[model samples]
Target: MSTVSTHVLDTALGRPAQGVPVRLSWITDDEVVVLGTGSTDDDGRVTELAPDGLEFGTYQLWFGVAAYAITSGQSIFFPEVTVTFQINDERHYHVPLLLSPFAYSTYRGS
Candidate 1:
């Protein structure tokens, strides 16, 4: 089984992106399956989008940014972001995002 998590940071504001809504999905050649969804905490971490004993498959993470940026008083061009990755091993996957209106980055974390 595999586990998945994520953390989001607001680079422009130099702080955690709190209250950002995220949707976790399982993706395949055929279609996408919704795994779970949650909002980031004060620390911008969503550590448990799925239950324990997660299954291995291709997964997609969608983050809502327009509302978040607007509420935070920043104008944003990209409203939503999608990240697709494969989770095949029995280890845990932490997908971290450093984001701003003009740029964003992601990686497979610890």
Candidate 2:
């Protein structure tokens, strides 16, 4: 079993990207199964996407950025972002997003 979490930062604003919607899903050969959905809190963290343990497989984290861009009064080139990762062990997976209106970055964190 494994666990996953995420954090979002608004690079342009120099603050946490609060209330950004996120979706957690599992991907298989034929279909995608949604595991959970949440939004970033005041700290820009969704620390419990899946309250239960996650099994080994391919997973995708989708972030909704259009609303965030509108709220920030900026035009965004990419309205959404998706990060796909594989789970191969029983460890904590921390995926952090460094985001702006036109660009974003993500990395496997501690």
Candidate 3:
């Protein structure tokens, strides 16, 4: 089984994006199944989206940028960011989001 983890960073502020809501979902052919939900900690990390691990399939991480923006007082163009990825192995997957008001980037992390 595979495990998933994530963190968010505000590039404009150069700090961890605390209190950002996040969701994990497993995607099927017809519907999306929510796996877990949590908000980022003080260090901007959600260490356990799927605590029991996962099967090889497609998954998504949903970030609530609008909520974060509202409280952080930052104007954001993208209200939310959804990243879809495939899990084909039994290794740990770290998906990190580098975010700004106008743009964001994500990459597979170690």
Candidate 4:
């Protein structure tokens, strides 16, 4: 089984983005099923979105940025960010997001 985690960093502020809402979803050919939901901790980390286990397939991590924008008082262009990835093995997946007001980037982390 596979597991998932995530971290959010505010590039514009050069700090961790706390209190950002996050959701995990399992994607199928027909529909997307939400598996878990959480908000980033003070360290800007969702340690384990899927504490239970996951199968080898496609999944999505949805981050709600509007809350952060409101709290930080930053004008953000993207209110939400979605990252879709595939899990093909029994390993841990860390998807980290580097975010700013206008742009964001993600990568497969350790």
Report the number of the highest-lDDT candidate.
3
- Write the number of the candidate with greater lDDT, choosing between 2 and 3: 3
Give the per-residue Cα lDDT of candidate 4 at 108: 100
Please give, for residues 1-110, the per-residue lDDT of candidate 1 as tens digits: 88888999999999999988999998878998898999999999998899764677888999998768977898877888899998777998999988898888999999
* Overall lDDT per candidate, in order of appearance: 0.89, 0.93, 0.96, 0.96
Candidate 2 residue lDDT tens string, 49-100:
8889799999999999887887778788889999999999999999999998
Q: Which is better, 3 or 4, measured by lDDT?
A: 3
Cα deviation in Å at residue 15, candidate 2?
0.4
Alpha-carbon deviation at 66 in model 3, angstroms:
0.4
**C-alpha lDDT of candidate 3 relative to the true structure:** 0.96
Give the local distance difference test score of model 4. 0.96
- With a 3 Å backbone cut-off (N, CA, C), the pairs that clash in candidate 4 are none
Tens digits of lDDT, candidate 4, 19-106: 9999999999999999999999999999878889999999999999999999999999999999999999999999999999999999
> By TM-score, how accurate is candidate 4?
0.97
TM-score of each: 0.94, 0.96, 0.98, 0.97
Q: Between 1 and 4, whose TM-score is larger?
A: 4
State the TM-score for model 3. Answer: 0.98
* Displacement of the residue 92 alpha carbon in candidate 3, Å: 0.3
- Say which prediction, candidate 1 or candidate 3, comes out ahead on lDDT: 3
Arrange candidates, best TM-score first: 3, 4, 2, 1
Off by over 4 Å in 2: none
